[model samples]
Target: MLKEILVHCGHSFCKQCIQKALGAQQQSKTPYSCPMCKLQLGPILELQKNFQLCSIVEAFLASTSKGQQQPGRLSRGRRAEKGVWG
Candidate 1:
C-alpha cells in the first residue's frame, strides 16, 4: 500500500521514500530539501497525510486490479500528474 504523505514543497510522496531520503541525508550540514522541487527546508520536515490522494490512488489501483474503469475524477488527476494543474 502506498502511504502518501505531503511534504513542505506541496508534493506528495510515499512515507517510506521520504524516510529513506531523510535517512540518506542524515549527518549533513546543509538544510533538507524536497526531492521533487529541491526546495531547501528545515532540518525537521513536517509530514502531512494526504488522505484524499491516498483514496484516489487506492481507488485507481483497485479499479485497475479488477479490470474496471477508473473513476471520473481520476482523469483530471492524471492531467495534474502530467503538469496540467487545474
Candidate 2:
C-alpha cells in the first residue's frame, strides 16, 4: 500500500482497500470492521487524511527496490493492494 490510511485501531490500510470495503456496504454510514482484528471502524468518510506515511514509502521505494514484493525486480503484473506494502 503506497497511499496508506491509518485507522482508529492504529492499523494502517491502503486507501483503495478501505474504499472497496466501504463500496461493498449497503449504506454510507455502515461501519467497516478491521480485516485483521475485526474491530468496528467508523464511517470511512470521517477518516482523517494528511498522514505522512506516503512520503516515507515514496522515499523508500525510490531509494531501493525493497518496497516491491519481488526481491531485486518489479512485479510482473499489478498485484492486489492489501493493508501492507507488497
Name the candidate that leads on lDDT. 1
* Best TM-score among the predictions, by candidate number: 1
- Cα RMSD to the true fold for all candidates: 6.5, 7.4
Tens digits of lDDT, candidate 2, 8-75: 77777788876677677636655677666778876544555537877787777876575545465544
Per-candidate TM-score against the hidden true structure: 0.69, 0.55
What's the distance in Å from true for residue 73, model 2? 12
Scored by Cα lDDT, where does model 2 land? 0.64
Error of 2 at 16 (Å): 0.6
What's the CA RMSD of model 2 in angstroms?
A: 7.4
Backbone clashes in candidate 1 total 0
TM-score of 1: 0.69
Clashing pairs in 1: none
Report lDDT (Cα) of residue 40, candidate 1.
78
